[model samples]
Target chain A: MSRLGRVLLGSLIPIVVLVIYAFATRSGLDPYYPSMASISSRFSELWLFERVGSDVWPSMRNLAFGYLVAIAVGVPVGLLLGMVVWLHDLLAPLIDFARSVPAIIFIPPLILVLGIGDVSKVLIIALGAGFPLLITTIDGVRKTDRALLDVARAIRLSRRRTIWNIVLPGAAPSIMGGAQTGLQVGFFLLIASEMVGASSGIGYLMMRAQASFDSPTLWAGIVLLSLMGFVLNLLFLAVRNRIIHWHLAMRAVSGSR
Target chain B: MSRAMRKSILGVAGVVLSLVLWQYLTVGGPLAQTPGLPTASGTFERAVKQAGDPELWSALATTLVVTLAALLIASLLGIGVGLLMGYSKIFSTALDPLVQFLRPVPPVALLPVALLVMGPTSNLAILMAVVTAMWPALVQTLVGVRGVDNVTLDAARAMVLPPLLIQTRIVLLSALPHIATGIRIAASYALLMAIATGILTGAPGLGRSILFAQQAGDSALVFALAVYAGILGLAISQAFSRIEGRLTRDYGPTAEAAAS
Candidate 1:
């Protein structure tokens, strides 16, 4: 079968399921299920006005700020830790313990300390995102090819110049991979922290809808959150592919061979 | 001192130094002004005390049970689906889009829906966890199965080996290393989801206790519970690593290497 035909065939099941759900609710077979029309209306309502300003925008802002903070701190610290053997050894246990703890656990204490504000949420997201990137970056930097370093030394390159040119470039692929993972972690924590204590944001919106028993609104929040995650991941992938095109090309060649 | 001994001493010193700094900041330094923050010694003492609390123990037990159950379910379903997709090009092509679409959606986003459909129960928590944890195992298994050498399969076919025997002896064995990778990843997700579900729904777990402690302004207790959760995560991950190491010892490290 053609690729398009296979995709259509695969999609048919989910479509049929949705159709059955819509019909079931429309015919009042299940009062709990929100009808398709109501869900769509709620979606537009959120997208057009009420939620866009109050919930979606705030959530996106927090996510962006948190991610930026994570990258800014994680990359440099990771490089230093990875490059300095004594520092790595001294901090290994502490880092392991910190990373093992789930980021959600920190939300409560942070809320207590920072109050129910954007700062707390952003910090939680940053902490959640930072560890993965830090670990990956350290691994990448530590694994820098000895042969490349030797070549740099053969050319009489200074330590700073060697790292700037050879080490950073060599570690770029792993660092980027870490960044991708960190984004996912950041998004998860963003919703989680928002849910725990917040007046606005998609997670808060969902919680409020649930409390009010507004099924359609709740469903709308879920749909919007899913779309946000999906779109952000695609955007990250596009950026990563562009930034590390050479590394990817090299990987492809080696993989095929 | 030898290099290893020096490193060990420095590591211990790092821990001690951090503890002293933590104590000073919360007990006497500028951070002492921060309300509700506990001293380092107080937090550690509370953590030890909390270990004996029946409620805390029960919550921890509930989380462990839910996580293990979810992991088991996810691994079974993931391996089955992965094998099906790997063995059939048409099936894989059909499912690729759906998998891609759903994979990136954080499982926490499904909590409200799960609560609505299933109510706030342990079952709901398990369902959320299973959904979240299944993907890694499924994807890894698919990759492992697809990478199985075609020449070996062709040789088995020429020898007229039974299909079941061929699958068990060749494909499945080759796929074990990759499946192990998936299981390891899924195990972490399961623990995270279990805690998240517990906290969100007040479904009886360490997460709920942590929330309770925070709400009560018992910062020491909160810190203790957080430490327990971290210990649990580390233990599970270490256990999986050991198992994976043994499994991949003879597999030439294809799947495990890619994973790490």
Candidate 2:
């Protein structure tokens, strides 16, 4: 098959199956599948476009603030730890300890310390994103090809220049990969944090729906959350691809990994 | 005794120095007056007191059970399905779209559906946990299985080994590393989600205790629960790493290298 034909073939089968299944269930030949009308109504109710910005904006704000703060702290600290061997050795155990803890576990104590407002939500997301960002950054820096470093030194590159020009670029992909994972995981934890106590945000909205047994709106909240995560990840990938254009990992991994 | 030992000692001292610095800055300086922030000794004492409470241990155990149950279910389903997919390209390609679609959706997003269907029980928590935790294992197992050497498979087939036997002995061994990686990832998700679920639903666990303590403004109990949760996470990860190391040693360098 041609590439377009192959793509069509690949997608067509599922659509056909769904259509058949819907017809069967609707016509009462099958009781297992929900009727097409029910499914469509559910889909429409759960769709992202249905949600107002007021219900969605606070969670996005918290997620953005938390993720950015995590990146800020994680990247610099990771670089320092990676560059300084003695420092890395001394703090390695502590770093491992921090990373091993589940990010959600921090929510309760954080809520107490930071309160139910945006600060606590941001802190929880920060904790979730921080470890992966830091760990990957450190690993990326530490694993820089020694030969490249030697070549830079051979050319009489200053230490600062070598670090800025060679080291950062080399480690960019790994750090970015960590950042991407952190963002996805951060989104997961952010919703839970919002649900815990906050009065505003998508999570709180979902909680309210649950409390009222409003399945449609609850599903809608989930769809909105999923859309936010999906869009943010795509945006991150685009930015990452642009920034790490020269990265070998990006070249070799076919931009998927 | 040796240079490595000396370096280790120096590392320890550095940590101590850093901790001292942290303690001073956070506890004695301008930061000390910050609300909800506890002094080092204060946090330590709080943790110790909570540790003395029997309810703490029971809550911890409850959380552990929920997490373990979820991990077991995820691993079983993930491995079984992953293996089948790995063995058959048609099966994998067919399901690939579905997996891709579902995988991007944060597992917690299923909470609304789970809460509706399962109704705030430990089962709801486990359902969320299973979905989130299974993907890593499934992906890892598929990678591991596909990565098995063609030579090894040909050798087994040449000997006229039964398909089941070949799969059990050769395929499973080849997939062990991927399986281990999946377990490690799953364990992290399971533990984290278990706590999150517990908090959300008022389930019986350390998560509930932490939430209750926090709500009640029991600073010491909150810190203690947090510390305990942290310790549990560390222990599970450390134990998994140790197992991964042992398996890597036993299986050969290729298997070790491929596991993660």
Q: How accurate is candidate 2 locally (lDDT)?
A: 0.78
Question: Would you list the clashing residue pairs of candidate 2?
Answer: none
The DockQ value obtained for model 2 is 0.45
Q: Give model 1's TM-score versus the native structure.
A: 0.93
Model 1: runs farther than 4 Å from truth? A28-31, B1-4, B149-166, B254-260
State how far residue B194 of model 1 sits from its true place (Å): 1.0
C-alpha local distance difference test of each model: 0.86, 0.78
Q: What value does the lDDT take at residue A187 in candidate 2?
A: 88
Superposition TM-score, candidate 2 onto the true structure = 0.86
Per-candidate interface DockQ score: 0.64, 0.45
Please report how far candidate 2 places residue A241 from its true position, in Å: 3.7
Candidate 2 lDDT over residue span B1-113, tens digit each: 78677668767877677667756867778777666666667777888877788999998888889889999999998988898888986677666666655666787776866
lDDT of 1 by residue, B66-128 (tens): 999999999999988999898877778778778888888888887877787788678887898
Model 1's CAPRI class? medium
Query: Which number leads on TM-score?
Result: 1
